[model samples]
Target: MASGSKWTYSQNKRFEDVLAEYAEDTPDRWHNVARAVGGGMTAEEAKWRYELLVKDVELIESGRVPFPKYGTPPGEAAAAKAAARTGRRG
Candidate 1:
């Protein structure tokens, strides 16, 4: 895969699994993560991807991005209305 290519769902899942195996203080953590993630990803790419994931989590936690409602069908206005009435952010 090219350096600029986006990660596939499987690749992202593998990355997350591998990341959990390697702690932040682990030596050569990025290299290990890249090797585990495979798909021709380099250490820098794995590190960058992790950083992006962290930023995404931060945004959601800060309410800058709405939390996704899983299993909600498209055009489900009723769910949104119910959530609004219950004072829930989604």
Candidate 2:
């Protein structure tokens, strides 16, 4: 469950979905994947499931893309501050 040091509910969910889809054994299925985590999946695994990460990152990034609201601006500084106070880097 603790996929990595930065894994969150959404990240874990994305990882699980990627695993399930990849397990289907359909190389052409083209699943989403992201290297958003430090060690949830190996580099090969992330590359194999690149689509899953794309989707996950898309979803996460979309919240602030074009214009980040909620005073979160989608920056490392804000993220770091948030993480320090709430343990959430994203």
Scored by TM-score, the top model is 1
lDDT of 1 by residue, 1-90 (tens): 555677665666678899999999999999999888787788998888889899989999999999856454444668798889999977
Q: Which residue runs of candidate 2 sit more than 4 Å off their true CA positions?
A: 1-4, 28-90
TM-score of each predicted structure versus truth: 0.69, 0.28
lDDT of each: 0.82, 0.53
lDDT by residue for model 2 over 15-35, one digit each (tens)? 667556555465533323333
The all-Cα superposition gives candidate 1 an RMSD in Å to the true structure of 8.0
> Cα deviation of 90 in candidate 2 (Å)?
29
In the predicted model 1, the residue pairs found to clash are: none
What's each prediction's clash count? 0, 10
TM-score of 2: 0.28
